[model samples]
Target chain A: MSTSPVTARLDRGVPRFGGFKLAIVRLEIRRQLRNRRTVFFTVAFPVFFFLIFGLNNAYASDPIGRGNESAFIMISMALYGTVLATSNGGATVSVERLSGWSRQLRITPLQPSAYIAIKMATSLVLGLVAILSVYIVAAFTHKPSMPLGLWFATGAAIWIGSLLFTAFGLFIGYLLPSENVMQLIGFALMLFSFGGGLFIPLSQFSHPLRVLATYTPLYGLNQLVHYPLVQGSFNWSWLSNLVSWLIIFTVGATWRFKRDTARV
Target chain B: MAERDVVPRTPPALELKGVRKDFGDVHAVRGIDLRIEPGEIVAFLGPNGAGKTTTIDMMLGLSVPSAGTVSVYGRTPLDAVRLGLVSAVMQSGGLLKDLTVAETVEYTAHLFTGARPVDEVMERAGISLIADRLVAKCSGGEQQRLRFAMALLPDPDLLLLDEPTQGMDVEGRRAFWKAIRHDAQAGRTIVFATHYLDEADAYADRVVLIREGEIVADGSAAEVKALASGRAVRATLFGADQATLRALPGVDHVEVHANSILLHCADSDAVARYLLTQTNAKDIEITARALEDAFVALTGSHARDESVQSNADEVLR
Candidate 1:
């Protein structure tokens, strides 16, 4: 056997960051965008909810916080959109796991950290798209009355806060089988959104339910994102909730990923 | 100067020392010890459930062994793989169904440090024409070729193909092997697992026959074929005593069916000559035992053991 021109120049060093990792993120984004179901649920659903819930005059007539009720609903809907986008993006890992793509990746030069980074990066990108789309719709139609800085701050907060759900999605994607992943994620998302005051204000919940709502994973993210528009100050509970859930989900995701990839 | 002098030789391409794998109660691979030298094209010849895929998975570091070690080029399997020293075309379920052929190739190419140019690899795999086709729309053979192209991306020194041509048509299989042969000629150490004896015989420099998770035979095609108790000579002879024919030189066993005598012989040529000159034998036929028969003969012992265990249970009951 003789060496070929291609084999002669084989590079043996470990690759630097940003080459293959960025390619993986780009490919993941392209593939996710191609899935109409993902787009509809992540981007379109929250916008649709905003149109239905935000158009009413009752919330606008009654001032709830720093802004009016329309502003509150808009921020909640955007947060919901980001949550959906990031969670769905993370959940796609279940399909990839089932398809043995993770196994294929294990045999490659690409580091496991790089693969996780790619997934997180992709989820963040999709979350950005979801947040911006909802915010754009609200800016045009609902015209929620708020200072321009607060609006951008709220959007940034929601986008950043969705990282917890992204980790949550990763935890479940690696923990659950592919067949049960979407159903579980959908049910969990509905419950979290309701409890977190994304769909309904926590003030409207019964005393016991409102207590439980504070403990839900999304509660902290919801409060954090709405703080700028509603409170204009940080709530210690909101910061603690977000930090605690982030740590839990990140640890769970890392453990599950290691266990899943280590299996024969 | 010789080519070997021009380049320093590396360690063995692959080495498995007392490798074992267990899936709960079922021991998929009992213990396998193998050393494959660099530039050797070895075929892991085995039937389904004979641990070929498991062995390949362990070698590729897709699965960790229950015990012992597997190394490629003296590095741990995973380390070797990460260094782009080894690559594999797995049997199935490794590909993304959504990506187009070209996208898949390009995407995988980007994951490696020194992948071959995408278009060159596509052309080499004979998938250039179908580059625009979605992976889900490609045929089984096309998907295999796509996997082949991915394996070639890193220009890996050692290529592991797990039942690479499992579902290909005859022509597709021929072309697949042609491309593999091209790789082999370019100094790649190729290890492919296959149930097809002819594939091992034709394409591999050495054939390692595995049965019930252990290597039953390891040698060249002819050498492995010789592991089965030799060839059979059939001849028409009237009123010939089976006992007398069984006692002939080179003959191991004899079966008489009507007027024809079947002699299982270590040396079929000697038996044939004896049958032609001394005996009133006619219409003689000598057939070497096919690898299929050898495989059955090798694995049949397990079936026999199970039956014996069942018989003992019945007696106890």
Candidate 2:
């Protein structure tokens, strides 16, 4: 019942990115890259879409603000690739949980928060790589034209946003059955992209649908990333929607992660 | 009562006080109070749903006990784990199939702040030869060794293994235990759960036999066996009278078959001594009951006793 001796033997307090935290992140990154099918799909899927649309001469010449419609299309494709890579990275925990690796981890010194941080870092690294792959492909084609500043901003926005959504991916991973999690996440990705007006402009949608699109999880992200390219009116609502979803995803993920480790 | 109440200066390696777990209306662990000192190897012998795993879960901090406390070196289970004082090799399914054996060890090692050298632990677990093989491609025994390698990373003060030798062939099992024996010699605290009583008898210094969420007996291997039932003394003795044998000290039952007699008795030594001096008994064999026999006698129904024929053996020849 005495507290002093027990606390004395304790290894002090946990530090953020202390000890083997960075090492774990590096390992996760390696694991993510080793998943060849996911890597192929994540880069190839968006790159394939960009090739079909961004390379078209008609779309190339069509300018809106600082760039042509093709530039906008490239940004969208880059965002898709980034999200695909990161979400896949996060959702891989479903397999880890099902395989009892998470349970295995429970016996180790790795704190769950440190573990979540490691996972996000690894996913975001892939997200960064995915953005560059599409951008690199777009650059070689010399078809998409945008301001240099917009290019960096949009890519950063997309990459950072993907970090937030890893929480959502992790939440889904813990909540859903591991067997069909990847497929369900894939379907969810498609639904979110379309609903958030990533594939098509919200202006192209019917009146009610455009309003509904504004409320979707990806809509705020889509708008935030494309804001520099379009130079449209900045809506405060967009930032709020994004922040709200971040809060939701973070809360849901940590809750689910804790529940499994603290079973009845 | 657990030894924790003795108020020793140095806390015991593991202390459980009336620890119980409940899954809704079902009580998985009714109550358990156990204390294990450092450097002792203990085995939890139990049936399928006898709450061994549940107790282990509570000890690993994988689940909270519905009541009471479980501490390692006086700290909480989670705290003990987070301090890298404890590690486990579970029964199965902790390996990533896609990862090569080395990668699996390296990845697991990265989770611990002060993990021992990956190569060293791999060699210790006798898994260095197959380091490049993917876990999915490895045989069942190989994968289990890989898990052992991972568990060894932190050089934990206490090691808990749940059915560590389950699914292993006899040769593989012996090899695995050889690795464990090397660790046991280093004065590490080890607690393992297993239905394989031979494993318990051979490896554990002390056995805590559990059944239906209760500890039926907690003692040394021989003491637990003695606690369950008496040993049997069999020999060839012509003209042995059943009534006279029953009258002998420590002899409970006497059965004569032609020129042979088998005495079921509490004290095999006393019965054997009397048979040698008084009767014309030869080929004298005092067979102590196997832990498997004691396990069956302690847990579950008598029906399953016949199924463990392979476990029977003669002792004290």
Candidate 3:
């Protein structure tokens, strides 16, 4: 057999993380965008919550901290959306793992780090969509009356701070069995939302329960995103809490990923 | 024969050196050493739980060996795959259910550097007709064909298929092997694992029979068949001396019943002739063993040898 045509088509160069990684990212984004259930949870659910809570008359004029109740409710809903979008994005790994696609990828040239990076990037994009969707709803219905700087800062803080949940989602995706994954995630999301003061402010709770709420993973993010709008300053405790949980979740995710991809 | 004679001087397409894999207390593969030259079509024939998938996983770099190493074209398996030197069609569940057949092929093609044209690959894999069907809706045979298309994307020089036709009907199996033969003619090395004796006999240039995590036989189909080639002679003889019957020419083993003697021999015709003329024997019958019997006999002996070896090791310890 002549070798010229076959040899010419062989790509001998080492694979780099450029176009190939982007291709995977694009593929994942397109596939996830088609899932209507995921779209509802990550994009629409939070917008609905924002609509219901932002239009309430109970907290509309009442002063909580720095911003009135409407602004506070809007920020809380936006944070809820951001966390859900990012975590749900990362949680898609469970489906891939269950289908044995991860093993298929192990045989390919794509590096594990590149795969994780693509998932995280996709999560960030979804988080951006969620935040914007909530903000758009707020703009049309009842826009929060806060300074422009504080508004941008709050949005930026919510987007960046919600990244910890992406790692958390990956950790759960690898840690739990696939069958119970979504149910557990939904239950945990509700618990975290309540405990982190997203639905109800921690101030109403007793001293001990309020203190416990501060230690939850979502608590730091909630406080950080609300700081500029609610307090107009950064809290060192909240920053430390965010940084520590970030490290913990990132470590947990990497460890679980390595173990999951190892030979069964 | 024509392909084997042109032995290229370059490194083999795949080489496994003393590879062993242990999962907790279960030893999946134990010390497998194999080499397949480029353009050679080799079949791994084994029964269930015979370590075929584990070995294939190591070869594809999806699983690391507990001992020894695997080299693909003088480089690591992962590197060889990265360079488009090798690709594989796994046993099951690699395709995403959400994507259509054509979309799956397109997405895989985008991952590689210079993938072949998606339309041509779909045609070659016989999935062009079902290009728009979602993977979840495709039948098992169609999904296998879609996997074949993905493996063809890189135009790889070496292809590994793990039970590529497991769920395929007879016609689909025939078409799949025909396509494989076409690729082999273009000088691509193919290694496939299957439990089907007919598939190995019909498709492989060399059949490697594995049993209990070890290679019991490796040769051309005919050559391996020769290992268990013999005939059985059963005859009813009155007043036959057991020693004299055992001493009969060409007889390898003898088992006596109440009214008959069964003989396993290299030349059943000779034994039959002796029994008819020299002894008061009646109702004599001779029959040759089938390839299935040969496969069983070959694998059965290996199982016995392994047990004996383990017993000896126990004694030594």
Candidate 4:
């Protein structure tokens, strides 16, 4: 009957991005982290890949078949983290869209930019975490790098590589059905990790596979990261290759999302 | 209805003009012209799949209308969203699955400049005790309340709800109705779709009935009921022939089902006397049609025929 309480509450006002959209992101992250299966597949899957590809062969004897093998394995490990994080971000977005959350948010005052920004931020943070988690184990226990510059370059390479993967992931998010998101992420991870010099270096493959690997985004990232970290040199060809894939994927993702949300 | 006395010439808080939506080949909402003035609660009444949701969706700008326009508070619904002048409680309850009740309300409290505080809205929504618990873990009733709280947070002039109490128990439903009435009395415009006729009767200042994507009836509860435009005298007859009952005076229609005969007539008193004199039936009951009977009569017999199986569960459970 009295208006004092409602009026008093109104006087204090809403927090900045603290309610709807921000809350949605926090809730999404918490839910994802709580799901042990998702956590393992996303956060811990890269670690598993690192163990199988980076440590077993490169850290063992027999020269790992070539001096460049460890560099290839590190690239594969970093690629594994970036791909997993970016794909998960897309999958999460698609699931929410199918589950009616997107429509619910559409009715609210939340802007489309805020919606896209949240997903991008979540993916970047997840990518950084995955990259750091894998690199820490690699640097100290095995394949130790002595120089600070290589570490910095490795971080930059991972960031650039992740940007491409995240863009590709966004494209996949709009293309795939919500029910098939997990399967798509898994399929892409395996395809790139094996043929793109993540598990086995390009030099170890046949002439055809080696040539095919150079055209893949994963291969471009491998070359970009490998040149600076292992050979201590930058390659313009590798940077161009990565940027070309990045441009293609970014354009595709932006176009797809705009079409999906348009009023007409 | 009493609140209608307060605001004299207020423009409609919500309006839908010739709105239409087609999902692929199926026409969902077809040419709906609706208007609700300030301080009025209008209940949208319809059976399932009658385009009630699609209509509400267009009104809230969740789905763009295929034809015509939807406006809220004299502006487009999309603009209303930007001004925080419209809020909604969707059928799914729209609560973030992982956040606790407190977090959901607290977060929504941040979306507007004049939103109610987290604690105050929680108490008002009667979810203060479950504030720290995750919304997904709450009971259906609690989740519904939490959604209403989220809608309330913005303190908007127009509130839209879809099946707002679909899953609540009787007591919870009663409490929810009380809150809704309180808000309506406070001069907020509301438009809600509900399956319960009593909800429309008890809380709504106006009721609109939609059937197969068309507006079949629209008016105040009694005014809409008046669309049936007839009265009936139901008599308890012993050893009477159904054939003779059909021939009674002032009777327009006669339906024979199981043990009783429904005599649809213009004058209840005339029919009662005629039934007593002709059929020798005692205990004749003469009564005006309730909203349900009026709704059935106006919408025709096909309205609740398919719902008979679920009617028991819908009424008692």
Reference-based lDDT, each prediction: 0.84, 0.83, 0.82, 0.71
Can you write out model 3's per-residue Cα lDDT over A1-264, one digit (the tens) per residue? 322222323446546683256666677787878878778887798889877887787667577566677888888988887888788877878888888877776666666777788888988888888888888788777556777677788899888887899998899888875856866887898899988999987999899999998888888889888887777567788878788889998999999998886664
By lDDT, the best candidate is 1
Better of 2 and 4 by lDDT: 2
Give every prediction's interface RMSD: 5.9, 4.1, 5.8, 8.2
Q: What would the DockQ be for model 1?
A: 0.37
Instruction: Compute the TM-score of each model's chain A versus the native chain A and list the values.
Output: 0.91, 0.90, 0.90, 0.80
Output the worst ten-in-a-row residue range by lDDT, candidate 2 chain B.
B308-317
Please write out the lDDT profile of model 1 over residues A25-70, one tens digit for every residue. 8888998898887888888999999888887876664675667777
TM-score of each: 0.83, 0.83, 0.83, 0.77
Give candidate 2's TM-score. 0.83
Question: In model 4 chain A, which range of ten residues has the least summed lDDT?
Answer: A1-10
Residue runs of model 3 more than 4 Å from their true location after superposition = A1-10, A18-20, A61-67, B1-8, B226-317
List ranges where model 1 is wrong by over 4 Å: A1-11, A18-20, A61-64, A232-234, B1-8, B229-264, B267-317
- Alpha carbon deviation, residue A231, candidate 1 (Å): 1.5
Candidates 1 onward: DockQ, in order: 0.37, 0.39, 0.31, 0.23
lDDT of 1 by residue, B1-317 (tens): 37645564456788899999999999999999999987899999888888999999899887889999998877778777777889999988777888889999988888877778999989988899999998999998899999999999988889999999987887789888888887688888999998777788899999999888999889998888666658878889998887778888877778898998888779888888888898899999988666447576544654675689899999999
TM-score of chain B of each: 0.74, 0.75, 0.74, 0.72
**Span of ten consecutive residues with least summed lDDT in model 4 chain B:** B297-306
